[model samples]
Target: MFKTIKNDLPASIVVFFVALPLCLGIALASGAPLFSGLIAGIVGGIVVASISGSSIGVSGPAAGLAAIVLAAIVTLGGLENGGFEKFLVAVVLGGIIQILLGLARAGIIAYFFPSSVIKGMLTGIGIIIILKQIPYFFGMDKNPTGDFSFLQVEWDNLISGLLNSLNALLSGNISVGATVVGIIALGILLLWSNVLAKKAKIFQLIQGPLVAVVVGIIFFLVTQGGSLGLLKEQLVSVPVPDSFDSFKGQFSFPDFSAIGDKDVWVIAFTIAIVASLETLLCVEATDKLDPDKNVTPTNRELIAQGTGNIISGMIGGLPITQVIVRSSANIQSGGKSKMSAIIHGFFLLISVILIPTLLNKIPLSVLAAVLFIVGFKLAKPSTFANMYKLGWKQFVPFMATVLPMAITGDLLLGIGLGLAVGIFVILLKSFQNSHFLHKEGEDVNDGKVKMTLAEEVTFFNKGAILKELDNLPENSSLELDVSKTRYLDNDIIEILEDFAHKAKERNINITLVSERGTVENPPSYIEFFKLRPKAS
Candidate 1:
């Protein structure tokens, strides 16, 4: 663990920068107190990281959960009572349910997802990140900076925001200094991995996000002295607690009184299911990005996320999950172990406590610069190339998942659509060639003993094959071939073996040649035949 810490610390800084805005942005979007986001971030990093089996995955408040949180608040809080505390109860219960799921080994659900679907999901998220950050990058902070779905914002509002921005520029309402800083930050970020960093060896020692943040602060300082059109309102400002005591007062406990409400349970189950699925997805993606090929145990990750959410809810934080943004940043920053994740959580805790004022001084545009880079990596050209190379079977699912996710507001819905398409293709292929044909008079004495495979040969194929064998005349030789079969599902293998035994009792000889394997019904019979491996 200590060795893991050495590699994780630097990566932790990168993840920390990536996570900060997301935490606040998700909270803002959810109509929850900003501190709730911070609390979730802290717990997700520290509590979850400490227990999670993942080496590179970073957990925190996710934008995906914002709608659920908002809806739960409205439904459980009774519009008048600010059911915010009741929502917190749901979060706690959700955590408990997640822990149960992990124990039940439900983490394998991640494996059920096709690789194309996962890639599409990542790409969809990348596009969303870029779009959402545009407003922040341009200094238009009126809208929440975390919405991934374009449908969430009306066309009129989008057009108006763009037109108003141009008007602001013409009317001299835009902060030229902030804009300059934002542009500079983006320039530095773009060049951080390029010639500038290579030429200036000193730049190699600093991360792009860290440098961008510092430059943003310096620009703010320079402009603050003269009030040169750059105002405090123009910068990113999280809620600053007046004192340590005031900060502690932000913590809210779950209202156990709401446990009796069926609505609360419904919200709780939703949270648990959504949060766990999201976390598992993040874990799988982070592992793919990890250079070491370290595989995180999904079950353990669920348990860790559950534990963190429980703690976060008890302390008045939003629901937590393994977040891909921070995890990807951690990987790109050379994170090697869970230590980076743990350190990032610690950073979130310490930053809010000791440097709240400085955090406020940092500009949103700078964070946008950081996120832009992260988004670019997720949707990089190489990603597209790799998916294409995987062939149409893979690419189809990838595009199906990506396009729908980009258009639809729901991640699961997009994936469900893609999976449906993939299954349909599979079924079509099965139906087209779902048969095993043996030549009439080649391997057998007569054409009467020829064998043909079932249209759908599952484990249940055993019964059908056995019944066919039972109908065969005694002392007859049969040629059973499954060369053109589309599916040689597992159950069929067992059935074939059972038929082999029955064939011996009837003094019947059988030859089995399939896409899977060759089986001579008589153990003493010897003939080589081609077979195909089972599907993964």
Candidate 2:
């Protein structure tokens, strides 16, 4: 993991910059202490990265869980009445539950998700990232950076938020300085990534995001107090500690006293289930994005995340999950292994300890510009065309996931919708594919109608197979072929038995063909099936 420090170090720096604002913004949105977000970031980096099997996945306080955290905090009692502390207890308990889930092999749920749906998720999130950041990119920083949900912490959903920013821009209710700096920063990033980085090894050694951030800070410093200057609200805000004691004071220990509360347990289970789901989804997506295509162990990843959450909660941090944004950013920045994630965590810890004031000087717009590239890369036009070319079996589920997620700003909802569509398509195909019919006199010139069963005939095939049998002409000879079938459902066997009786009354002579041998006018279908060996 440490072998690619040259690549990982620079990539970690880029991820750190991208993660910093998100950490703060997610905390702000969650109604937790801003410092708690930083704590999650630090632990996710140092602790989670160290334990997790994932090479490129980055864990942190997830924006996807912000709404749940906010609701839980309010439900357990407001922040004033030791609510946040009690929530920490839930976080720790959630970790325990996640560990149990991992032990139970629940991580296999990730494999059940369709590839089209997963691709749709990545693209949907990319579109959301771009849409969410537009306000920030244009210097109309109204909403929190990391809150990916449709309903904003401020007001309105994603579309309205964009319109609001556009209106603000037209009405001159925007920061010209931040916009100017953002444009310049974007230009620098584009030039560095597209042109210069390809020219030399040194260019790749120093990343574009880091350069963009530094230029943003310098621009802010140069324009301070001028008409075209960035306001404090337009810049990254890390909670600055006045002293060592105060810094230590920022950490909030879990309120173990609330362990007996039923609500706490409910919240704990909710977090465990949601956080695990998010982590698994991210793991699958990250593997797809990986240039090396190294598959992370999902079960191990759950255990790692659970452990991270336990440590994070004990130290007053929010719940942690493997986040796609930072993970994708790390990949885009050339991160080769887990070292980048670990180094980025250390960067979070060290910066907050030593140079938080410096970090605060960077402009939010510049970061928005950096994320624009990440979003574009994920939601490229070519991906849409490619999915379309794969046919409706792929494209339908892809759209079902992407469209709802992009419109509603709900990730899981989109996945559920896509999964539903995918299952329906599977059933439809199964129903259509149950049997292949060789019409009368096609195979044997004896006017026999032959129906070949599929490789695996299940209850889902019952309707189609029954319909074919019922349609057979009177006095016709029918051949039932199961030579290709490996496993046949009991329901299908029963259907064949009923068809046999019906065929006898219709004067149809039945011939059953199997791998064992052909049966002539079998008396008991079940008896014949029982004599055959079970599928391996």
Candidate 3:
């Protein structure tokens, strides 16, 4: 652990800077106290990283869960009267549920989600992050950080909404200081990540987002109290405790009594299901990104995340998950082992304790600028075009997942819709290729009609095959072949037997072909099916 410090220590500094604003930003989004995000980040980095089998995964409060967290808070009736406390109860219970799932080895459930659906999920969240951050980009402070619903947050359409934001800026509704700092911050982030960071070791060691925040602080100090300076509301407001003794008082606890509430259990189950799924998916993606190509044990990852969430909720923190953005940053910044993640957590703890006042000066716009880049990277135009080229089978599901999530602001709904579309495509293909009809000896009406059954003919194909048998040409002879079939369904066998009985109605002669000998007048399908050595 100590040996990798050369690589891991510097990488941890970069990750620490990256995690700082995100922790605040995600908490800001979740409608929770800013310090809670820091707590989750610290616990994720320190507790989760220590236990997780993943070498490079960095856990933290996820932007993706902001919606769930917000909804849970609202459902419990806000922070008053043990509401937020009840939500913490859910988080704790959710952690236990995750532990149970890990014990049951349910991590394999991630494999069941289609690739297109998962990509669509990442892309949709990216788009959401972009949309949610736009208000901050222009220094518009009316909207909350986590709120992404177009129906609630902005105008009827995206263009009009952006135009409205521009109109607001023109009308002096913007914070000039924040806007200026944000632009420079975004410029630094792009310049460092795209150009200098890759070209020079020094730039790589010192991350872009860190520079952006520091520059934002200097900008705030230089411009504070001026005519165009940022308002107090426009900056980060991590509650500054008067003393270390008082700081301890800010931590919240769960209302164990709420464990009996039905709604509490519902939210707990939702958090467990969603958080665990997101973790598993992120584990798969992080493994693919690992330079050493190390395979993380998925079940163990669940146990670690479960433990992290339990600890985070016990004190005061938003729910946690394996965050892809931080994990990706860790890998890109030369993180080799879990020690980098562990160290970053310590940084989060130290920074909050020692410099809450200094950290509070960070302009929300600077963080918004940082997130805009993260958003664009995830939802680039190339992603959509690549999915398009994969053809409709893949593309349709991808779009189905993206469009609804983008519009409706619901992640689970978007995935559910995508899965429905994916299943539909599968069923359509099955319906199309259930059976095959071929022309053989001569004319279409007068000659042999050779019908071949697919290898596995299920009930879905019974209708198409039945239709073909009904339309058989009068005075025609037919050869129905099942030789290629491996497992014929009872439905198809019944259809064939019924067709054999009615062939004489059309003056049609029939011969049934299979691995068994040919039958001129076919016997009961059950008897014929029974003749196969292994068929039952």
Candidate 4:
């Protein structure tokens, strides 16, 4: 772990900056107290990171959960009396369900997803991040929430906000001082590694995000005077606890009385499923990006995430999952082990406890600048180039997953659509090749019915194969040869069982042959067929 310090330390700083605003934003979106987001962020990082087996994956309060949290609060607490504390109870129950899933080893479901769909998911998320962060960057903060839908803003609200900004510009209500400093900070971030740092080699020691954040803080301080047109209110302001005890008092507990409510179970199950899926997907993607090409243990990761969520929820934190954005940043920043993830968690814990006031001094616009860069990196031109190079079979699913995710605001729904399309493609290939022929009695005979196995068969193949077997004429001689087959799935074997039962009704003779063996005896087909073990 110590050997990872060089990479992990820098990576931790990047994740810390990325996570800060998200914590606040997600909290704001969830209709929860602003401090709840910080609590979630702290727990997600420190608690989840400590337990997760993934070297590069980062866990946090996700934007994805904001909608659920908000809805649960509204429904369970009653619209007028809705309290965020009730929703916390649902999150705690969700964590318990997640732990059960991990013990059941259900994390292996992630392996069934195609690589194309996974790539599409990352690209879709990247696009959403870019679009959502634009308003924040431009200082337009009147939108309802950060839900990942393509729903348009209310026409009146959008027009009014634009007009308000325009009027503010004319009346000098806008902060020219903050805007100027933000531009300079963005410019420095864009060029620091390329121009200034190279020219002054010693400056290279500072990371870009650290520099940008530091410059932003200094700019806030320098422009705090009345003459500079920067108001203290314009800066990022987190709630400051008056003392250590006051800060500790902010922690919340789950209201287990609500656990008996059916609604609580529904929300809990939703969180468990979505959070687990997201964590598994992130784990897979992060492993792909790891320079060392290390493969994380998926089941172990599930266990870690489950443990994290249980802890996080118990302590008033939001549900935790392995987040792709932070994990990708970790990989890009040269993280070599889980130490980077663990350290970032510690950073979150330290920052909130020791420097809450200091954090409030940084500008929200500067944090937006950091996310803006990250969003762009995820949806870069090179990503498109690489996907296109893989051809339509890959690109179609990628787009099918991405486009819907961007439009519908549901990650799982989009991937489901993509998987549906992928399965259709496979079936088309299978149908085109579904033919078999054989020579019997020394030549082609009138009593022989040929059969062919689909290119690949699974449990889903049972119906089609069974249908064909049922249609065969009585007293017919059938030869089932799978010599040219690539995959003879287990579902097809079940279909064969159906065929055996029907053999007496049709008065049919059946023969089975493959690369390994041939079956002549009616009752010995299972023993006659020899299958090679599938390659791992």
Model number with the top TM-score = 2
Task: Write one digit per residue (lDDT tens) for candidate 3, span 1-536.
Answer: 77777778877876876677678767876877777888899999999999999999999996668878888898998976568889999999999999999999987665455557777877887787787677777778644344233433456645566677778867888777778888999999889988997798888777787889899899889887886577777777666889978899888988898889999999999999999987987786676556666557778989999999999999988899998778877886789999999999999888788887997788888888877876777789999998787568779988999998887666678888987886687566544343444434446656677777766665445445655776778888888787877766454565566566667566888888888778886657757885676644
Return whichever of 1 and 3 wins on TM-score. 1
The total of clashing pairs for model 3 equals 1
For each candidate in turn, the TM-score is: 0.77, 0.81, 0.73, 0.74
Write the residue-wise lDDT of candidate 4 on 419-502 in tens digits.
798667656545434332223332235677666554455434434564566667787878887766665533345346546766
Give every collision pair in model 4.
none
RMSD to true structure for each model, in Å: 11.5, 13.5, 15.1, 12.9
Residue 308, model 3: lDDT of: 93
Q: Residues 186-280, candidate 1: write the lDDT tens digits.
A: 99888887766678746655777788899899888877767443566556656778887898787788889878999989998999999988887
lDDT of each: 0.74, 0.86, 0.78, 0.69
Model 1 — TM-score against the truth? 0.77
Model 3 superposed RMSD (Cα): 15.1
Against the true structure, candidate 3 reaches a TM-score of 0.73
Sort order, TM-score high to low: 2, 1, 4, 3
Model 4 CA lDDT for position 421? 81
lDDT of 2 at 293: 59
Kindly give the stretch of ten consecutive residues in candidate 2 with the minimal lDDT sum: 434-443
Error of 4 at 32 (Å): 1.3
Tell me the RMSD of model 1 versus the true structure. Answer: 11.5
